[model samples]
Target: MAYTGETIDVDATLQRLNKAASERGFDCFSLVEQDGTVVPYFTRAAKTESAPRIYLLAGMHGDEPASPLSVLDLLENDLLGMGVDWTIFPMLNPAGFRINQRENHQGVDLNREYKAPTTKEVKAHVEVIEQSEPWDLALIIHEDWESEGYYLYDLPTELTDGWAPRIIEAVSRVCPIDLSDSIDEMSAKGGIIAPRLEDIDTEPKLMGHWPEPIFMHAEGKIRGTYTFESPSSFDFTTRIQAHNAAILASVELLLGSKR
Candidate 1:
C-alpha cells in the first residue's frame, strides 16, 4: 500500500531547522544535493571534554513523518541543553520526503544504502561520520506502520545496559509499548530487541543494504545505539510524543552516567 499520511513541507522544515540550529549555536552543514535540494546536518559541541557525545538522526524513511517532526520539536524547545556534544541529521532523504515515499526518488532505500552507499545522501552522511569523532550514543528515530505499539532495537555495548527499560518506561507515559515477543522477525522482550553482538559480527554484508546502526557498529564508531520505532498507525501527536520521550530519556541516561 502507498503512504497516504501527512507529508512534510521539506523546504519549510529545512528553513525552521536552519533557524533553530543557528539560534542554538549549532554548526549547520549541507550534506548533499538531491534534485537541487541540499540535505542539511547540524552539530553542537560540548562545553567540557568529559561530556558525552550523542547523535540523533531522523527522517530516514520519508513515510515516517513524525520522526523528523519530533526532532524539530525537541530542538525548538532547546532540549539539547548544555553538557553534551550533539550531531543531528534531521532529514536524510529529502527526495523521498518530498513525495512521502519510503525510498528516495531514485527508488533507493536510503536506510539500506549504508553498506554500499550508492546514493549521494548515504555517501555524504558517511563522510560526516568519518570526519567527526566517535559518538558515545546514537539514537535513530523511526516508525513502523505495522506495529501496534512503540518498540526499540538496541545495539548493546558496555555503555547500554539498563537503558532500554528507561526509554520504554519514559515512552510508556506517552504511548503504549509493543509487548510482542517478536518484532521485525527478531526476538524481543518488552518492546526491546537487544541483538547479540556475535550475531551482528557474523551477519552477512549484503550488497547495497545496511541499516545505519549496523553500519555504525561495523565501523566501530559508536559506543551504543538505539533505533526507536513509534507505531505510525496511531495519531501523529502520540507518535511524536513517544519519539521525543524516548530521545529525551536516552539523553538523560547518558548524561546521568557521567555524573
Candidate 2:
C-alpha cells in the first residue's frame, strides 16, 4: 500500500521521544529550527557518562516514516535503559515525512549528500556525528521496497568476531535474514543488500559512485557500523515492528559485547 501523503508532524514526534526519554532519566537535546518549518534532529544520551557512544539515525528518506516511528517505539519502551550513549535523529527530512516524499525540502537525497552535505538535514547529521565523542557503534534505520526481505549493511570495523554475528542472530529471530541470493540482487544494483539480518567481518567498500555516508564519516574512529533496511513490501505496521526489533537487538548486542 502506498503511504498516505498526509502531514506527519515530526517535531511533535521528537517532542514525544524527548519527553519519554527525559521521564526515564536520560539526557536529551533537540537541534530544531526556530520556526518549526523543518524536522529537527534530536540526540538522547544516557544520564551517566558511559562507555562507547552508540548512534541511531532514521528518516534520511522522507517516505520512510517507519524508521522514525520505530525509534519512537524504542523511546516509549525506555529502550535506552540498556545503556551506552545514544545520538538518535528520528527524522532528518521533516518536509519529506509530511508529504511522504523520498527527499528533503531541497529535493536532494540526504543519504547521497553526505560526501557534500547540501541540505540542512545532512548538515545537522554531520554536526551530531562530528561533535559527539568517537562513536563505538552506529545503526542507521532505512527501508527499501525493491527487495523481498529485510537486510543489513555491515561496515568495516575493528571487532567483528562476537559483535557482528550477535546482531545478525538477534535480528533474524524476528525477521528472516536475507540469504546470499537477496544480497546478489542488491549487489547487482551496486552494493550488497541485507535481505535478512547479516554482518560483514571485513571493512565494507566506503568509496564509489554511491558510498555509504556512515562509513565515510565513521572510518577510523568507530568500532562498528551497520545499516538496517526494512522492506516496504511488508505491511507498514509489520515493517515498523521489524525496525524496532532491529533497534532493540542492536542495542542488546552492543551492550552485551561490553560485558
Candidate 3:
C-alpha cells in the first residue's frame, strides 16, 4: 500500500528537469524553498494570445516519481505542442523525494496542507497560485501505491464537463483503467471519480485534506482539473506512459476545441 521501491536519485532527476526546461525555452525560477530544498517553477508563454493557458504539476508526493517523470519525458521529447501558455511545477516535495518517502522530510503531506499550510512547500505553492491567472485547464499527476490500475479525479466547469472519459479512452491504449465502483472513498464510474464540488463543506476528505486541485477550483483559479493516478504497483514504464497519455489527451481536447 506504500512505495517501497529502489532508491531514487532526486538530485539527478532535478538536473534533468533543469536541462529539459532550458532546452524547451521555459523560464525556470526558484521561487519556493523548504528544508534547504527549492521548489522550482517553469513557465512558457504561448506564441499567440489566443492560445489556451494551461497549468501542469506533478510530484506532490516523493514516492510518486512516475508523475514527474512523465512530465520530463514530455518536455525532453517536445511532445507538448505549440500554442498554449504553460505554468509547470514539476516537483514540489524535493525533501521527501530525496529520502524516497511519501511526505516531506518534516513528515507532512504537502498536497493535504493547502488549507493551512504549515510546510514551507505548500505555502509557497499556494502563494504562486494566488498570484497567477485562472488557467484553462489544470493537470495534476500522482500515483496511488495501493491501486490496481490507473484512475482520475475530474472537477470540471461547464466547458469541461464530460472530458474525463476522453482522457480515459486515450490512456486505455497504454494502461488498465481502475474500474472500482469506489475510489479513494468516493463513488466512481468508468475509471473516473467526479467529486461533488458543491459539497466541499460537507465532505470530510475535502474539508480536512485540501488537495491542490480542490483548492484551485474552490478559489476559481482553474476552469477544469484532472488528477491522474497511475497504479504504482505496475511497471514504471507503463505508469509513465499512462500519465503521458492522460496529459496529451487533455491537450488534444483543448486544441481540438479551438480548431
Highest-TM-score candidate: 3
Model 2, stretches more than 4 Å misplaced?
1-12, 32-38, 44-50, 180-185, 188-212, 215-221
lDDT of 2: 0.63
Model 1, runs deviating above 4 Å: 201-208
Ranking of predictions according to TM-score: 3, 1, 2
Count residue pairs with overlapping backbones in model 3. Answer: 0
Candidates in order have lDDT scores of 0.88, 0.63, 0.88
Cα lDDT, model 2, residue 117: 62
Per-residue C-alpha lDDT of model 2 across residues 118-222, encoded as one tens digit per residue: 566566666666766777777888887655667777654555344555665666666655554446234522223432222221234323213344434434446
RMSD of each: 1.7, 5.0, 1.2
Report how far off residue 102 is in candidate 1 (Å): 0.7
Query: Looking at candidate 3, what is the lDDT of residue 241?
Result: 97
Worst 10-residue lDDT window for candidate 3 reads 1-10
Query: Candidate 3: which pairs clash?
Result: none
Candidate 3, residue 36: the lDDT equals 84
- For all predicted structures, in order, the TM-scores are 0.95, 0.79, 0.96
- TM-score: model 3 vs. ground truth: 0.96
User: Which portions of model 3 show Cα errors greater than 4 Å?
Assistant: none
